[model samples]
Target: MIFAVVGPSGAGKDTLLSGALAARPDLRLVRRVITRPTKAGGEDFEGVTEAEFQTRLAQGAFALTWDAHGLRYAIPHDQINGPQDVVFNGSRAALPEAVRVFPDLRVIVVTAPDAVLAARLAARGRETVSDIATRLSRAAFTLPDGIAATTVVNDSTAAEGISRLLAALQPVRA
Candidate 1:
Protein backbone atom coordinates (compact mmCIF):
# COMPACT_ATOMS: atom_id res chain seq x y z
CA MET A 1 0.00 0.00 0.00
CA ILE A 2 1.10 3.55 -0.68
CA PHE A 3 0.12 6.00 2.05
CA ALA A 4 0.03 9.68 1.24
CA VAL A 5 0.41 11.53 4.51
CA VAL A 6 -0.97 15.00 3.93
CA GLY A 7 -2.08 18.11 5.76
CA PRO A 8 -1.56 21.86 5.81
CA SER A 9 1.71 23.49 6.70
CA GLY A 10 2.68 23.34 10.41
CA ALA A 11 0.35 20.41 11.07
CA GLY A 12 3.30 18.26 12.23
CA LYS A 13 3.08 15.78 9.35
CA ASP A 14 6.85 15.38 9.20
CA THR A 15 7.27 15.05 12.94
CA LEU A 16 4.50 12.47 13.27
CA LEU A 17 5.69 10.52 10.22
CA SER A 18 9.24 10.49 11.61
CA GLY A 19 8.08 9.01 14.90
CA ALA A 20 5.87 6.44 13.19
CA LEU A 21 8.74 5.28 10.98
CA ALA A 22 11.01 4.96 14.02
CA ALA A 23 8.59 2.56 15.69
CA ARG A 24 7.58 0.68 12.54
CA PRO A 25 10.80 -0.55 11.02
CA ASP A 26 8.98 -2.51 8.36
CA LEU A 27 7.50 0.57 6.80
CA ARG A 28 9.34 2.68 4.25
CA LEU A 29 9.39 6.48 4.04
CA VAL A 30 9.78 8.16 0.67
CA ARG A 31 12.16 11.08 0.56
CA ARG A 32 10.69 13.80 -1.63
CA VAL A 33 12.55 16.06 -4.07
CA ILE A 34 11.95 19.75 -3.54
CA THR A 35 13.22 22.91 -5.19
CA ARG A 36 13.79 24.53 -1.82
CA PRO A 37 17.21 24.72 -0.19
CA THR A 38 18.05 21.93 2.23
CA LYS A 39 18.32 24.36 5.13
CA ALA A 40 14.71 25.48 4.59
CA GLY A 41 13.87 22.59 6.89
CA GLY A 42 10.68 20.66 7.31
CA GLU A 43 10.90 17.18 5.96
CA ASP A 44 14.27 15.75 4.91
CA PHE A 45 14.22 16.17 1.11
CA GLU A 46 16.60 16.21 -1.81
CA GLY A 47 16.96 19.87 -2.66
CA VAL A 48 17.71 20.76 -6.24
CA THR A 49 17.90 23.82 -8.45
CA GLU A 50 14.89 24.75 -10.58
CA ALA A 51 16.71 23.79 -13.75
CA GLU A 52 17.56 20.40 -12.33
CA PHE A 53 14.00 19.88 -11.13
CA GLN A 54 12.55 20.69 -14.54
CA THR A 55 15.10 18.45 -16.21
CA ARG A 56 13.97 15.52 -14.10
CA LEU A 57 10.32 16.40 -14.72
CA ALA A 58 10.88 16.38 -18.44
CA GLN A 59 12.57 12.99 -18.15
CA GLY A 60 9.43 11.54 -16.48
CA ALA A 61 11.31 10.70 -13.30
CA PHE A 62 8.52 11.74 -10.95
CA ALA A 63 5.44 9.71 -10.11
CA LEU A 64 3.68 12.79 -8.78
CA THR A 65 4.57 16.47 -8.66
CA TRP A 66 3.08 19.74 -7.48
CA ASP A 67 3.95 23.34 -6.83
CA ALA A 68 3.49 25.24 -3.57
CA HIS A 69 5.05 28.23 -1.91
CA GLY A 70 6.92 29.05 -5.10
CA LEU A 71 8.69 25.68 -5.16
CA ARG A 72 8.19 22.37 -6.94
CA TYR A 73 7.98 19.03 -5.13
CA ALA A 74 7.99 15.50 -6.49
CA ILE A 75 7.83 11.88 -5.43
CA PRO A 76 10.25 9.87 -7.53
CA HIS A 77 8.75 7.04 -9.59
CA ASP A 78 11.04 4.39 -8.09
CA GLN A 79 9.88 5.09 -4.53
CA ILE A 80 6.23 4.36 -5.22
CA ASN A 81 6.82 0.90 -6.63
CA GLY A 82 7.55 -2.38 -4.81
CA PRO A 83 5.56 -4.31 -2.19
CA GLN A 84 6.56 -2.32 0.88
CA ASP A 85 4.00 -0.05 2.53
CA VAL A 86 5.52 3.28 1.50
CA VAL A 87 4.61 6.64 3.02
CA PHE A 88 5.23 9.97 1.34
CA ASN A 89 4.86 13.52 2.53
CA GLY A 90 2.14 14.67 0.19
CA SER A 91 -0.22 17.55 -0.45
CA ARG A 92 -3.98 17.34 -0.23
CA ALA A 93 -4.43 18.97 -3.62
CA ALA A 94 -2.32 16.26 -5.22
CA LEU A 95 -4.25 13.36 -3.75
CA PRO A 96 -6.44 12.89 -6.80
CA GLU A 97 -3.42 12.52 -9.08
CA ALA A 98 -1.82 10.18 -6.59
CA VAL A 99 -4.95 8.06 -6.46
CA ARG A 100 -4.95 7.85 -10.25
CA VAL A 101 -1.35 6.64 -10.22
CA PHE A 102 -1.56 4.22 -7.30
CA PRO A 103 -4.94 2.55 -6.99
CA ASP A 104 -4.17 1.25 -3.48
CA LEU A 105 -3.27 4.64 -2.10
CA ARG A 106 -4.50 5.65 1.33
CA VAL A 107 -4.44 9.21 2.58
CA ILE A 108 -3.74 10.19 6.15
CA VAL A 109 -4.72 13.77 6.75
CA VAL A 110 -3.10 15.12 9.91
CA THR A 111 -4.91 18.03 11.49
CA ALA A 112 -4.76 20.42 14.45
CA PRO A 113 -6.77 23.34 15.73
CA ASP A 114 -6.12 26.63 13.97
CA ALA A 115 -4.50 28.11 17.04
CA VAL A 116 -2.18 25.15 17.41
CA LEU A 117 -1.23 25.34 13.75
CA ALA A 118 -0.47 29.04 13.99
CA ALA A 119 1.64 28.57 17.10
CA ARG A 120 3.60 25.75 15.53
CA LEU A 121 4.28 27.69 12.36
CA ALA A 122 5.40 30.69 14.36
CA ALA A 123 7.85 28.56 16.31
CA ARG A 124 9.44 27.21 13.12
CA GLY A 125 10.87 30.69 12.42
CA ARG A 126 11.34 29.76 8.80
CA GLU A 127 8.66 32.05 7.41
CA THR A 128 7.67 35.65 7.85
CA VAL A 129 4.67 36.58 9.97
CA SER A 130 2.78 37.36 6.79
CA ASP A 131 3.49 33.96 5.37
CA ILE A 132 2.40 32.27 8.58
CA ALA A 133 -0.82 34.24 8.57
CA THR A 134 -1.47 33.27 4.98
CA ARG A 135 -0.97 29.63 5.79
CA LEU A 136 -3.22 29.91 8.82
CA SER A 137 -5.97 31.49 6.77
CA ARG A 138 -5.98 28.75 4.17
CA ALA A 139 -9.15 26.71 4.42
CA ALA A 140 -9.22 23.03 5.22
CA PHE A 141 -9.70 20.46 2.47
CA THR A 142 -12.27 17.71 2.29
CA LEU A 143 -11.22 14.46 0.69
CA PRO A 144 -12.73 14.03 -2.74
CA ASP A 145 -15.48 11.48 -3.30
CA GLY A 146 -14.36 7.82 -3.49
CA ILE A 147 -10.98 8.62 -1.92
CA ALA A 148 -9.99 6.54 1.10
CA ALA A 149 -8.58 8.67 3.89
CA THR A 150 -8.12 8.72 7.66
CA THR A 151 -7.86 11.87 9.74
CA VAL A 152 -5.52 12.05 12.72
CA VAL A 153 -5.43 15.05 15.02
CA ASN A 154 -1.94 16.00 16.13
CA ASP A 155 -2.86 18.70 18.59
CA SER A 156 -1.02 17.24 21.59
CA THR A 157 2.27 15.45 22.15
CA ALA A 158 4.31 13.86 19.37
CA ALA A 159 3.81 10.46 21.00
CA GLU A 160 0.07 10.87 20.89
CA GLY A 161 0.15 11.74 17.21
CA ILE A 162 2.43 8.80 16.45
CA SER A 163 0.13 6.48 18.31
CA ARG A 164 -2.79 7.63 16.22
CA LEU A 165 -0.82 7.33 12.99
CA LEU A 166 0.35 3.83 13.84
CA ALA A 167 -3.16 2.73 14.67
CA ALA A 168 -4.45 4.14 11.41
CA LEU A 169 -1.69 2.44 9.42
CA GLN A 170 -1.99 -0.91 11.20
CA PRO A 171 -4.43 -2.41 8.73
CA VAL A 172 -2.34 -1.26 5.79
CA ARG A 173 0.70 -3.00 7.21
CA ALA A 174 -1.20 -6.26 7.44
Candidate 2:
Protein backbone atom coordinates (compact mmCIF):
# COMPACT_ATOMS: atom_id res chain seq x y z
CA MET A 1 0.00 0.00 0.00
CA ILE A 2 1.21 3.45 -0.81
CA PHE A 3 0.59 6.31 1.61
CA ALA A 4 1.25 9.82 0.35
CA VAL A 5 1.40 12.64 2.84
CA VAL A 6 1.20 16.04 1.20
CA GLY A 7 0.57 19.58 2.33
CA PRO A 8 1.82 23.11 1.82
CA SER A 9 5.13 24.33 3.05
CA GLY A 10 5.00 25.36 6.73
CA ALA A 11 2.00 23.18 7.40
CA GLY A 12 3.94 20.92 9.75
CA LYS A 13 3.71 18.13 7.19
CA ASP A 14 7.30 17.07 7.72
CA THR A 15 6.98 17.08 11.49
CA LEU A 16 3.89 14.93 11.42
CA LEU A 17 5.54 12.57 8.96
CA SER A 18 8.65 12.21 11.11
CA GLY A 19 6.60 11.60 14.23
CA ALA A 20 4.43 9.03 12.54
CA LEU A 21 7.46 7.17 11.27
CA ALA A 22 9.03 7.18 14.69
CA ALA A 23 5.80 5.87 16.18
CA ARG A 24 5.01 3.24 13.59
CA PRO A 25 7.54 0.58 12.74
CA ASP A 26 5.31 -1.39 10.41
CA LEU A 27 5.34 1.27 7.69
CA ARG A 28 8.36 1.91 5.50
CA LEU A 29 9.00 5.59 4.80
CA VAL A 30 10.34 6.42 1.35
CA ARG A 31 12.82 9.21 0.72
CA ARG A 32 12.11 11.69 -2.04
CA VAL A 33 14.65 12.57 -4.74
CA ILE A 34 14.99 16.27 -4.17
CA THR A 35 16.87 18.76 -6.31
CA ARG A 36 17.91 20.66 -3.23
CA PRO A 37 19.50 20.03 0.12
CA THR A 38 17.34 18.80 2.99
CA LYS A 39 15.79 21.58 5.02
CA ALA A 40 15.93 22.02 8.76
CA GLY A 41 13.53 19.69 10.57
CA GLY A 42 13.24 17.62 7.41
CA GLU A 43 14.58 14.13 6.80
CA ASP A 44 17.91 13.65 5.12
CA PHE A 45 17.48 12.08 1.72
CA GLU A 46 19.61 11.47 -1.35
CA GLY A 47 19.86 14.90 -2.94
CA VAL A 48 20.98 15.60 -6.48
CA THR A 49 21.79 18.78 -8.31
CA GLU A 50 19.36 19.97 -10.97
CA ALA A 51 21.63 18.69 -13.70
CA GLU A 52 21.98 15.30 -12.04
CA PHE A 53 18.25 15.09 -11.48
CA GLN A 54 17.68 15.82 -15.13
CA THR A 55 20.11 13.08 -16.08
CA ARG A 56 18.36 10.58 -13.82
CA LEU A 57 14.99 11.61 -15.22
CA ALA A 58 16.30 11.03 -18.72
CA GLN A 59 17.42 7.59 -17.50
CA GLY A 60 13.84 6.86 -16.34
CA ALA A 61 14.72 6.66 -12.67
CA PHE A 62 11.64 8.37 -11.27
CA ALA A 63 8.20 6.90 -10.73
CA LEU A 64 6.68 10.37 -10.44
CA THR A 65 8.03 13.88 -10.35
CA TRP A 66 6.84 17.48 -10.12
CA ASP A 67 8.23 20.97 -9.70
CA ALA A 68 7.32 23.07 -6.69
CA HIS A 69 8.93 25.97 -4.88
CA GLY A 70 11.19 26.26 -7.90
CA LEU A 71 12.68 22.81 -7.23
CA ARG A 72 12.05 19.33 -8.53
CA TYR A 73 11.09 16.35 -6.39
CA ALA A 74 10.75 12.77 -7.48
CA ILE A 75 10.12 9.29 -6.18
CA PRO A 76 12.16 6.50 -7.70
CA HIS A 77 10.19 3.82 -9.48
CA ASP A 78 12.00 1.08 -7.58
CA GLN A 79 10.67 2.36 -4.28
CA ILE A 80 7.14 1.32 -5.17
CA ASN A 81 7.89 -2.20 -6.25
CA GLY A 82 5.24 -4.77 -5.29
CA PRO A 83 2.56 -4.09 -2.66
CA GLN A 84 4.84 -3.10 0.14
CA ASP A 85 3.36 -0.64 2.65
CA VAL A 86 5.04 2.72 2.13
CA VAL A 87 4.72 6.29 3.36
CA PHE A 88 5.99 9.45 1.68
CA ASN A 89 6.02 13.07 2.65
CA GLY A 90 5.64 15.01 -0.56
CA SER A 91 3.98 18.04 -2.09
CA ARG A 92 0.33 18.15 -3.08
CA ALA A 93 1.24 18.64 -6.72
CA ALA A 94 2.80 15.17 -6.69
CA LEU A 95 -0.34 13.34 -5.59
CA PRO A 96 -2.15 12.86 -8.91
CA GLU A 97 0.57 10.79 -10.55
CA ALA A 98 1.10 8.75 -7.40
CA VAL A 99 -2.57 7.88 -7.16
CA ARG A 100 -2.64 6.97 -10.83
CA VAL A 101 0.46 4.80 -10.54
CA PHE A 102 -0.49 3.17 -7.26
CA PRO A 103 -4.22 2.59 -7.41
CA ASP A 104 -4.42 1.51 -3.80
CA LEU A 105 -2.54 4.48 -2.50
CA ARG A 106 -4.07 6.60 0.26
CA VAL A 107 -3.38 10.33 0.60
CA ILE A 108 -3.26 12.49 3.70
CA VAL A 109 -3.37 16.27 3.40
CA VAL A 110 -2.03 17.88 6.52
CA THR A 111 -3.23 21.42 7.10
CA ALA A 112 -3.31 24.29 9.54
CA PRO A 113 -5.04 27.63 9.85
CA ASP A 114 -3.39 30.30 7.76
CA ALA A 115 -2.53 32.30 10.84
CA VAL A 116 -1.02 29.36 12.66
CA LEU A 117 0.92 28.24 9.63
CA ALA A 118 2.23 31.72 9.23
CA ALA A 119 3.30 31.86 12.86
CA ARG A 120 5.04 28.50 12.74
CA LEU A 121 6.91 29.50 9.63
CA ALA A 122 7.84 32.83 11.11
CA ALA A 123 9.18 31.08 14.21
CA ARG A 124 11.51 29.13 11.99
CA GLY A 125 12.65 32.60 10.82
CA ARG A 126 13.64 31.26 7.46
CA GLU A 127 10.85 32.85 5.39
CA THR A 128 9.34 36.26 5.18
CA VAL A 129 5.73 36.85 6.17
CA SER A 130 4.84 37.47 2.56
CA ASP A 131 6.36 34.17 1.55
CA ILE A 132 4.43 32.35 4.24
CA ALA A 133 1.23 34.02 3.10
CA THR A 134 1.75 32.82 -0.44
CA ARG A 135 2.32 29.24 0.73
CA LEU A 136 -0.78 29.31 2.89
CA SER A 137 -2.87 30.47 -0.02
CA ARG A 138 -1.58 27.60 -2.08
CA ALA A 139 -2.23 25.07 0.68
CA ALA A 140 -5.85 26.10 1.03
CA PHE A 141 -6.76 24.78 -2.39
CA THR A 142 -4.29 21.93 -2.95
CA LEU A 143 -6.55 19.08 -1.92
CA PRO A 144 -7.92 17.09 -4.80
CA ASP A 145 -10.95 14.80 -4.69
CA GLY A 146 -10.11 11.93 -7.02
CA ILE A 147 -7.86 10.25 -4.50
CA ALA A 148 -8.99 9.22 -1.04
CA ALA A 149 -8.12 12.46 0.69
CA THR A 150 -8.02 13.13 4.42
CA THR A 151 -7.11 16.44 5.99
CA VAL A 152 -5.63 16.69 9.45
CA VAL A 153 -5.58 20.21 10.83
CA ASN A 154 -2.36 20.98 12.65
CA ASP A 155 -3.59 23.72 14.94
CA SER A 156 -2.34 21.92 18.04
CA THR A 157 0.93 20.42 19.18
CA ALA A 158 2.79 18.03 16.93
CA ALA A 159 1.93 15.14 19.24
CA GLU A 160 -1.74 15.96 18.96
CA GLY A 161 -1.46 16.23 15.21
CA ILE A 162 0.31 12.87 14.95
CA SER A 163 -2.38 11.16 16.96
CA ARG A 164 -5.00 12.43 14.58
CA LEU A 165 -2.91 11.34 11.61
CA LEU A 166 -2.42 7.84 13.02
CA ALA A 167 -6.14 7.53 13.51
CA ALA A 168 -6.80 8.58 9.95
CA LEU A 169 -4.28 6.11 8.53
CA GLN A 170 -5.68 3.09 10.34
CA PRO A 171 -7.35 0.64 8.01
CA VAL A 172 -11.08 0.91 7.85
CA ARG A 173 -13.08 -2.26 8.42
CA ALA A 174 -16.02 -3.14 6.30
Candidate 3:
Protein backbone atom coordinates (compact mmCIF):
# COMPACT_ATOMS: atom_id res chain seq x y z
CA MET A 1 0.00 0.00 0.00
CA ILE A 2 1.12 3.52 -0.77
CA PHE A 3 -0.39 6.67 0.71
CA ALA A 4 -0.03 10.03 -0.98
CA VAL A 5 -0.51 13.14 1.13
CA VAL A 6 -1.18 16.30 -0.83
CA GLY A 7 -2.42 19.82 -0.21
CA PRO A 8 -1.65 23.44 -1.06
CA SER A 9 1.11 25.34 0.62
CA GLY A 10 0.58 26.26 4.28
CA ALA A 11 -1.88 23.41 4.68
CA GLY A 12 0.22 21.56 7.33
CA LYS A 13 0.58 18.52 5.14
CA ASP A 14 4.20 18.06 6.09
CA THR A 15 3.52 18.44 9.76
CA LEU A 16 0.80 15.85 9.62
CA LEU A 17 2.87 13.41 7.59
CA SER A 18 5.89 13.74 9.83
CA GLY A 19 3.82 13.14 12.93
CA ALA A 20 2.25 10.06 11.46
CA LEU A 21 5.63 8.77 10.38
CA ALA A 22 7.06 9.12 13.86
CA ALA A 23 4.29 7.00 15.26
CA ARG A 24 4.15 4.33 12.59
CA PRO A 25 7.31 2.24 12.40
CA ASP A 26 5.70 -0.10 9.90
CA LEU A 27 5.28 2.75 7.44
CA ARG A 28 8.19 3.42 5.11
CA LEU A 29 8.44 6.99 3.93
CA VAL A 30 9.76 7.50 0.43
CA ARG A 31 12.03 10.47 -0.01
CA ARG A 32 11.80 12.25 -3.33
CA VAL A 33 14.88 12.87 -5.45
CA ILE A 34 15.10 16.50 -6.38
CA THR A 35 16.88 18.85 -8.74
CA ARG A 36 16.81 21.90 -6.52
CA PRO A 37 18.88 23.34 -3.71
CA THR A 38 17.76 21.76 -0.46
CA LYS A 39 15.57 24.03 1.60
CA ALA A 40 16.34 24.45 5.32
CA GLY A 41 13.84 21.95 6.65
CA GLY A 42 13.56 19.48 3.79
CA GLU A 43 15.01 16.01 3.59
CA ASP A 44 17.79 16.04 0.99
CA PHE A 45 17.41 13.02 -1.23
CA GLU A 46 20.12 12.88 -3.87
CA GLY A 47 20.01 16.56 -4.78
CA VAL A 48 21.30 17.42 -8.24
CA THR A 49 21.37 20.41 -10.54
CA GLU A 50 18.76 20.78 -13.27
CA ALA A 51 21.20 19.78 -15.98
CA GLU A 52 22.29 16.72 -14.06
CA PHE A 53 18.70 15.72 -13.35
CA GLN A 54 17.87 15.98 -17.03
CA THR A 55 20.92 13.93 -17.91
CA ARG A 56 20.01 11.25 -15.38
CA LEU A 57 16.42 11.19 -16.60
CA ALA A 58 17.64 10.58 -20.11
CA GLN A 59 19.80 7.77 -18.77
CA GLY A 60 16.70 6.10 -17.26
CA ALA A 61 17.76 6.81 -13.71
CA PHE A 62 14.26 7.83 -12.69
CA ALA A 63 11.05 5.80 -12.70
CA LEU A 64 8.74 8.79 -12.97
CA THR A 65 9.69 12.44 -12.96
CA TRP A 66 7.90 15.75 -13.17
CA ASP A 67 8.61 19.46 -12.85
CA ALA A 68 6.40 21.62 -10.66
CA HIS A 69 6.71 25.00 -8.95
CA GLY A 70 10.15 25.37 -10.59
CA LEU A 71 11.50 22.18 -9.02
CA ARG A 72 11.96 18.64 -10.24
CA TYR A 73 11.04 15.41 -8.40
CA ALA A 74 11.79 11.81 -9.26
CA ILE A 75 11.25 8.37 -7.82
CA PRO A 76 13.52 5.52 -8.70
CA HIS A 77 11.65 2.30 -9.44
CA ASP A 78 13.71 0.06 -7.18
CA GLN A 79 13.16 2.12 -4.06
CA ILE A 80 9.40 1.49 -4.06
CA ASN A 81 8.88 -2.27 -4.04
CA GLY A 82 7.98 -3.93 -0.75
CA PRO A 83 5.04 -5.16 1.27
CA GLN A 84 5.69 -2.48 3.90
CA ASP A 85 3.28 0.39 3.35
CA VAL A 86 4.75 3.66 2.04
CA VAL A 87 3.86 7.27 2.61
CA PHE A 88 4.70 10.29 0.46
CA ASN A 89 4.32 14.00 0.80
CA GLY A 90 4.04 14.39 -2.92
CA SER A 91 2.64 17.00 -5.28
CA ARG A 92 -0.53 16.79 -7.33
CA ALA A 93 1.49 15.95 -10.43
CA ALA A 94 3.11 12.99 -8.71
CA LEU A 95 -0.04 11.42 -7.31
CA PRO A 96 -1.27 9.91 -10.54
CA GLU A 97 2.00 8.16 -11.22
CA ALA A 98 2.05 6.95 -7.63
CA VAL A 99 -1.42 5.50 -7.95
CA ARG A 100 -0.56 3.89 -11.26
CA VAL A 101 2.51 2.24 -9.83
CA PHE A 102 1.06 1.11 -6.53
CA PRO A 103 -1.99 -1.11 -6.67
CA ASP A 104 -3.49 -0.22 -3.28
CA LEU A 105 -2.85 3.51 -3.35
CA ARG A 106 -4.61 5.94 -1.05
CA VAL A 107 -4.63 9.66 -1.76
CA ILE A 108 -5.34 11.98 1.15
CA VAL A 109 -5.81 15.69 0.62
CA VAL A 110 -5.19 17.79 3.71
CA THR A 111 -6.91 21.16 3.84
CA ALA A 112 -7.63 24.00 6.23
CA PRO A 113 -9.76 27.11 6.14
CA ASP A 114 -8.18 29.86 4.05
CA ALA A 115 -7.90 32.07 7.08
CA VAL A 116 -6.35 29.23 9.05
CA LEU A 117 -3.82 28.67 6.32
CA ALA A 118 -2.97 32.35 6.21
CA ALA A 119 -2.43 32.48 9.95
CA ARG A 120 -0.23 29.37 9.88
CA LEU A 121 1.92 30.87 7.15
CA ALA A 122 2.25 34.08 9.08
CA ALA A 123 3.29 32.20 12.17
CA ARG A 124 6.10 30.50 10.28
CA GLY A 125 7.80 33.91 9.78
CA ARG A 126 9.79 32.52 6.87
CA GLU A 127 7.37 33.60 4.17
CA THR A 128 6.77 37.26 3.50
CA VAL A 129 3.23 38.59 3.51
CA SER A 130 3.33 38.81 -0.26
CA ASP A 131 4.41 35.20 -0.53
CA ILE A 132 1.62 34.09 1.72
CA ALA A 133 -0.88 36.13 -0.24
CA THR A 134 0.34 34.71 -3.52
CA ARG A 135 0.01 31.16 -2.29
CA LEU A 136 -3.42 31.87 -0.88
CA SER A 137 -4.46 33.33 -4.20
CA ARG A 138 -3.66 30.17 -6.13
CA ALA A 139 -6.84 28.17 -6.67
CA ALA A 140 -6.91 24.92 -4.75
CA PHE A 141 -6.89 21.81 -6.90
CA THR A 142 -9.45 19.07 -6.58
CA LEU A 143 -8.51 15.39 -6.71
CA PRO A 144 -7.54 14.35 -10.19
CA ASP A 145 -10.34 12.84 -12.24
CA GLY A 146 -8.46 9.56 -12.59
CA ILE A 147 -8.12 9.01 -8.85
CA ALA A 148 -11.65 8.70 -7.50
CA ALA A 149 -11.14 7.22 -4.01
CA THR A 150 -9.72 10.32 -2.35
CA THR A 151 -9.97 11.12 1.35
CA VAL A 152 -10.36 14.87 1.84
CA VAL A 153 -10.63 17.66 4.37
CA ASN A 154 -7.97 17.04 7.02
CA ASP A 155 -8.26 20.09 9.27
CA SER A 156 -7.47 18.62 12.65
CA THR A 157 -4.35 18.89 14.78
CA ALA A 158 -1.28 16.88 13.77
CA ALA A 159 -1.92 14.14 16.34
CA GLU A 160 -5.51 13.83 15.29
CA GLY A 161 -4.52 13.74 11.66
CA ILE A 162 -2.11 10.87 12.29
CA SER A 163 -4.78 8.91 14.08
CA ARG A 164 -7.12 9.44 11.17
CA LEU A 165 -4.45 8.23 8.73
CA LEU A 166 -3.78 5.11 10.80
CA ALA A 167 -7.44 4.31 10.79
CA ALA A 168 -7.59 4.84 7.06
CA LEU A 169 -4.80 2.37 6.58
CA GLN A 170 -6.48 -0.41 8.46
CA PRO A 171 -8.12 -3.20 6.52
CA VAL A 172 -11.89 -2.89 6.13
CA ARG A 173 -13.63 -6.01 7.36
CA ALA A 174 -16.90 -7.14 5.89
Clashing pairs in 3: none
Each model's total of backbone clashes: 0, 0, 0
List model 3 lDDT by residue over 32-147, tens digit each.
Answer: 78876665455647677989988888888776677887789887665567888877777777777777767577777777778878988899887899989988886277676778
| Runs of candidate 1 exceeding 4 Å displacement | 172-174
Task: Give candidate 2's error at residue 29 in angstroms.
Answer: 1.3
User: Which candidate has the highest lDDT of all?
Assistant: 1
Per-residue lDDT of 81-152 in model 2, one digit per residue for the tens?
755578888767767777887788888888888888888888888788788778777867745666668788
Clash pairs, model 2 backbone: none
Model 3 vs. true fold: TM: 0.84
Q: Which stretches of candidate 2 lie over 4 Å from their true place?
A: 38-41, 82-84
Tens digit of lDDT per residue, candidate 1, span 1-174? Answer: 789998888899989999999999889999999998898776789999999999999999999999887889999998777878899988888888889988888888999998999899989888799998889887377787788789999999999999999988877543
What lDDT does each candidate get? 0.89, 0.81, 0.74
Error of 3 at 92 (Å): 1.4
Evaluated against the true structure, the overall lDDT of model 3 is 0.74
| For model 3, the run of ten residues with the poorest summed lDDT | 148-157
Winner on TM-score between 1 and 2 is 1
TM-score per prediction, in order, is 0.93, 0.90, 0.84
* Cα RMSD, model 3: 2.3
